[model samples]
Target: MEENAISGDDNTHWFHSNGIITSIDNSQKKICVDISQKNSFFDGTNITLNCNKSSLDITYLEAGQEITFYFFENNVLDTEVAIEKLNIVTP
Candidate 1:
């Protein structure tokens, strides 16, 4: 099975959100993402997640970088792993 295909217990279901990074706080380990318009996976919502350590490092993340964040399973605070998942759609 794919890494992303892994499922978790209730209240721990993983969801992926895509948007330009609005702000980042490495000290507190948090990230703020906003999607102005709703899409298939998003609802024009601003998602704020508490980041944690991941298999990939995200220390160099900058604001305005297009990214898709994967919430860690079982953790209320989403973690930003330095995964190579850069998919952009230009319409």
Candidate 2:
């Protein structure tokens, strides 16, 4: 199984991660997530997940909230990333 594979049978390279919503940019339809803590799926300290590219409703999201999301780079073009799922994490 690959580290970021969606599943053993799936060939797609999907990754799951949870982080605090450091900021929300409705104008750009992007949310800045802080993944600096240990256990993050990726190494970046912060990543801006594009809501426009995701299938989620960003209208209900707010700053300081924790959320878990799944994303994957386009198989055809690795540079093109998309968020497949997003959910608010409740404490």
Candidate 3:
């Protein structure tokens, strides 16, 4: 049996990485997540989240909070992905 292909904003690239919020650069519209794991999913990854009007709400976020980010790619645009959800599980 062939496995179903994940596509179109369905988060085919989903993976969990524990990290602390190193900094929040509102001016740059980016957040620096410092992953401590040597083989972390985001070891040196500087993810640039879409914080536009159409993007997910992030007003509740704060520095040093451990959050689980759910990423979903845009169906229409392959290069665009947005944070589908964020849950703060730790401080």
Model 3, stretches more than 4 Å misplaced? 1-13, 27-29, 36-40, 43-55, 72-82
lDDT measured at residue 41 in model 1 versus the true structure, 0 to 100: 43
Ranked by lDDT from best down, the candidates are 2, 1, 3
Give the winner by lDDT: 1 or 2: 2
Better of 2 and 3 by TM-score: 2
Q: What is candidate 2's lDDT per residue for 1-91, written digit by digit as tens?
A: 1235565444565767677888887887878887635442445557777767655678788888988877764421221234777888854
Against the true structure, candidate 1 reaches a TM-score of 0.53
Q: Which stretches of candidate 2 lie over 4 Å from their true place?
A: 1-4, 8-13, 36-41, 73-81
Q: 7-60 in candidate 1: lDDT tens per residue?
A: 566455554556677798887666676754454443346665555545435467
Task: Give residue 1's error in model 2 in angstroms.
Answer: 17
lDDT of candidates 1 onward, in order? 0.52, 0.66, 0.48
Any idea what lDDT model 2 has?
A: 0.66
Models 1 onward score TM values of: 0.53, 0.69, 0.50
lDDT of 1 at 82: 29
Give the winner by TM-score: 1 or 3: 1
**lDDT preference between candidates 1 and 3, better one:** 1
